[model samples]
Target: MRSQDENGRANHEAGMAGGEEMEMVEVSSEMRRRHQRPRKEEAEETEEAMSVEQVFEGKRVPGWREQLTFRAFAVSFVLAVMFSIIVMKLNLTTGIIPSLNVSAGLLGYFFVKMWTSVLDKAGLLKQPFTRQENTVIQTCVVAAYGIAFSGGFGSYLFGMSETIARQTTELNDAQNVKNPKLGWMIGFLFVVSFLGLFALVPLRKIMIIDYKLIYPSGTATAHLINGFHTPQGAKLAKKQVKTLGKFFVFSFLWGFFQWFYTAGDNCGFVSFPTLGLKAYENRFYFDFSPTYVGVGMICPYIVNISVLLGGILSWGVMWPLINNQKGKWYPADLPSGSLHGLQGYRVFISIAMILGDGLYNFLKVLLRTISSFVSVVQKRGATSTLPVLDDGSPITTSPAVSFDEERRTELFLKDQIPKQVALGGYVVIAAISIITLPHIFSQLKWYYILVAYIIAPVLAFCNAYGSGLTDWSLASTYGKLAIFTIGAWAGADHGGVLVGLAACGVMMSIVSTASDLMQDFKTGYMTLASPRSMFVSQVIGTSMGCVIAPCVFWLFYKAFKDIGISGSEYPAPYAIVYRNMAILGVDGVSSLPKNCLTLCYIFFAAAILINLLRDLAPKKIAKFIPLPMAMAIPFYIGSYFAIDMCLGSLILFVWELINKAKADAFGPAVASGLICGDGIWTLPQSVLALAKVKPPICMKFLSRNMNDKVDTFITSLS
Candidate 1:
């Protein structure tokens, strides 16, 4: 039977190639009867054809039994587990560097790659694996794991430390006694870490279906799998694998040069300089640390912008005012035994900037969500219900289906009948959020928790909107906004660290590996890998990583504390909050700038109105503007991403232009080569680090200098 056009929607059973515009069809009872049986028959016929081809193609492997061999399962499990552990270690140790996260994602992609390749070899599926499949799976798994683990572990560790420090310090000051209850704090943190799982559910639909973000790491993995499946891929893989081995050796040598020679104190090599102009420095300065820049590159550009913006607003605007008012804007010389004035200024500025941004963003999100909800309800009341089939069946026989059918149905049903039933689901989610809110906010004081409850929904809405636009997750934005608000309320010194850590976790979970995951998913969809399997693999991998992350963080925190360097244990932002609380007291909460809060409220109100309007509009118009989300994100973050968008557009334009001039294969091959080259570049560094070799050229210069200083310092100091 010929497939019906059904408007423009592609027939899943048809197995059509290339990009074609397809229309979505509503499968009424008749349409289902017409198409379902034929599709199943076609699928069976295709399977038979595939089996015949396999018999002629090569040696026949047994069907299900052969595909699920012990060897394959063992390899997949080991790779997944080991990769998860390695990724957790690197992420916890290195902060949220994109490359590290991407590498971790690549490991996850490998499993998917292997799974697909094995299936192809067995001829269980007709379509062979592609690089894109690995990319999507790896990206999703890495992103999901990164966000959850980072947010959970980071929050638990930092929150525990700050809460204990605050309570004990308070006790010590008031009663002239010291308290040691690190164990209690640790126990409390473990309990709170479980809350991280709650975030996963709300985010699942958004990440998987609505946005359809692609994970690049999964694509890489699929490439590997494809290599094993096809003769062409196999030959190329062999050559490339050998080259990668050599590259690893080269990278290791280069990595060591900087690590050994130019990285220590007094070599003038490894200082972390705060960017922009410092009031005390009287000029802009640069820090000569390679680690920070390398790290900065890996960090999401949006985050960097947010951080930098916060610093600028605080130091460039707020601090100068405060200092000038206090008659200490500038001193002729450094104060006796005092902290670096510039650093101190920047720290304060950063704190205020966080306060402003968090406040503004959170309020906007809350208002937008509420507005969207109300608007949805209003639309339900006004719009005509979907007409049932003539046979009195609820299913419609339309060739075209609407987007968000479930939501529309729910709203329609809610509006058609009683007022009380309509309010039930809304109440349930709210009640659940509210009950969970206290547990989530348990570390904070009751009043502070109250404040956070008031603020969190706003941030959540903003995050949802932000996610809608760029196909980026907004977990970090919400978490950061939450932390900042909490810190501002609780006092900067005591609450800052807890909030910072929590924010770090949130950022790590949501933002760190988002792009890679989206790319992977897109590949999987194209390749026709089982979505259920991909989802299962992601959950399993992420859960394993999350389980062990806290322990690793604790160990790092202890080591850093001993060395008197902040390291992972002491985030500078949190420290600033603690100090402020000690000096200023709770009255400081009153001192929070009203301008920031007002701005937040304005954004929130505007978002709500936009969401309402969008929801009330016709579906066609609604498609053009995700107004609910647009209201939630800050202008600054949007602007930062605009830069990325422009760059991407330029690249695409150049590629299209080139493709027009050259063979179609040339442009695609060049693009593929660029991607492969980028991925390959990391292998050399990994190998070199493993081998403990000095790198060549400029890297060697840095390494040699580092070694000389270490030797000299050891002799003189001893």
Candidate 2:
């Protein structure tokens, strides 16, 4: 069978011509036991081959195992649902439930992973499933997670009905306002969530296939699947499984310790610390939580840079400038002058910066997409006049070579980019954009919507093709651009918009991680197992997650609040904007945040200019100038990643150098071990948490032991 290229184009004319003459290599019985039947020609080529037919003919189908079954899904689901109910009760008592606030979508992902693993072990589903199956599984998982984590339809309705009541209570004592009813809120959330999913589906083909977005998690999953295909792969997989089991145990305990020991106070194990620093008072603070760590690990260098830049602009540049102007030398009680206070200025600055960046980026992407579209159209037109060639027949009246004819003859031929697919994609984008317009307008006024819709596309185009940042999910740079426009129109108090944009960015990162995980597994399946079976596994996993996620969110929210933190404890930058709008008339927006805005704009502009000039400069000079990401990231966080990346690169370089010097081959095993070790180490925490056991202290103590083992192993091999 021929493999398709990224764009589905077939390039192997030789493979096509020599298809029947190819010999099949003998595959182990283990391999045969896992896969379906081979084609007739393949079976004939290897007489001793355990055909796909023999493997399934008399074998009993698998089902969920008793011990390691879909219990995770059920447990997650029940917990999530129960938590939502608990959130309602907690909301009544505490006013806000901090831990209850989490992404329902993420909860779904975990549920799906566990559920799919169960289904895979059981013979209910075929191995290597199709894309459709994957979709189904994902949907189910989301649903499951949602059921567990969501605050329920009734809760949203209650929130809506009590909005007036809550407002009234706020007027008397703002802190005493209870949580809003869940009915309408939940309804709206579900609606938007569904829309987001719908919007993503059409974009998948372009993003995943055409754009080839590398979902790191997906890649890991693919590696895992590949490992299941052969003896070597299975051995590696077994090791990973063991390592992950231990890691989860460790992580759970670590989480508990951080919650109990470090954070111990009137507020339970988790507390959002306030530094009392004027610039950060309104900002939510925490002592480096696991969620943050996980986020840091998952988010790429580029995004981290953007966030760091935003923070610096707000705290470093803007705050200092404001303090100097006031001649107060950073007063203890920094008067709340504007929306984000000093952070407001940063917001303004970010807007201006993103605008400039967006403009440059938009034109570039537009030009590329148009160019590609035109080229494809022309190719189709030209192909209409081409002569057909088949079965080695003589080409008659053919004026030019036919790429299509050549492509079709090969078994492992690349698929052509069909006109229909492209057209369909474009149509879907248009439809989604239109459908989402009202929601956008409702949330952001019409003027803001106009600016976002008009300017965002331009920025997206510029950034995507021009700067080589092809992942154009409106929530990234364009959202920053939108924030700028909103600030410009409504003033700096709307720094909350930037906060919202950041939240969206975080959500997108989560989604991207999940999607990437699926994609990686798909790649593995393509390489080793049946594609169909893998698809099924993915579907099963994703479905379970979907259903269970909501409940988890609810549980966490309640748990956090019961301990003392407010539900709104999560740094809701957007809430700041809402407060500003409510207090200061929309017309007095200028009196909002200013210092944060200025700093943001300054840094953003500087970063964009630096990157643009570097890109336009000669190759040698450009090489010396690192990507904008280096400048955009905050010095504190960026430095850590930089050092890590540098060290990793150095290790790889040294290994390659030594291997070449000694005339020895270095294999993928070393790299795989590093990657697997990192992922596996994190797994134990989850397992221990689920098991409701106190986290194991030995896991932490054994860190030195593990490192020593690794060092010894590496040195011995050397």
Best by TM-score: 2
Q: Tens digits of per-residue lDDT for model 1 on 655-674?
A: 55767443222322232222
Please list the C-alpha lDDT of all candidates, in the order they appear. Answer: 0.33, 0.32
lDDT string, candidate 2, 23-62, tens digits: 0000011111112234465446334322422322343322
Q: Which stretches of candidate 1 lie over 4 Å from their true place?
A: 1-107, 110-140, 147-149, 152-156, 159-251, 262-344, 363-472, 476-539, 558-718
Q: After superposition, how far is residue 203 of candidate 1 from its true place, in Å?
A: 11
Q: State the lDDT at 642 in candidate 1.
A: 22
Instruction: TM-score each candidate.
Output: 0.47, 0.48
Model 2 global lDDT (CA atoms, 0 to 1): 0.32
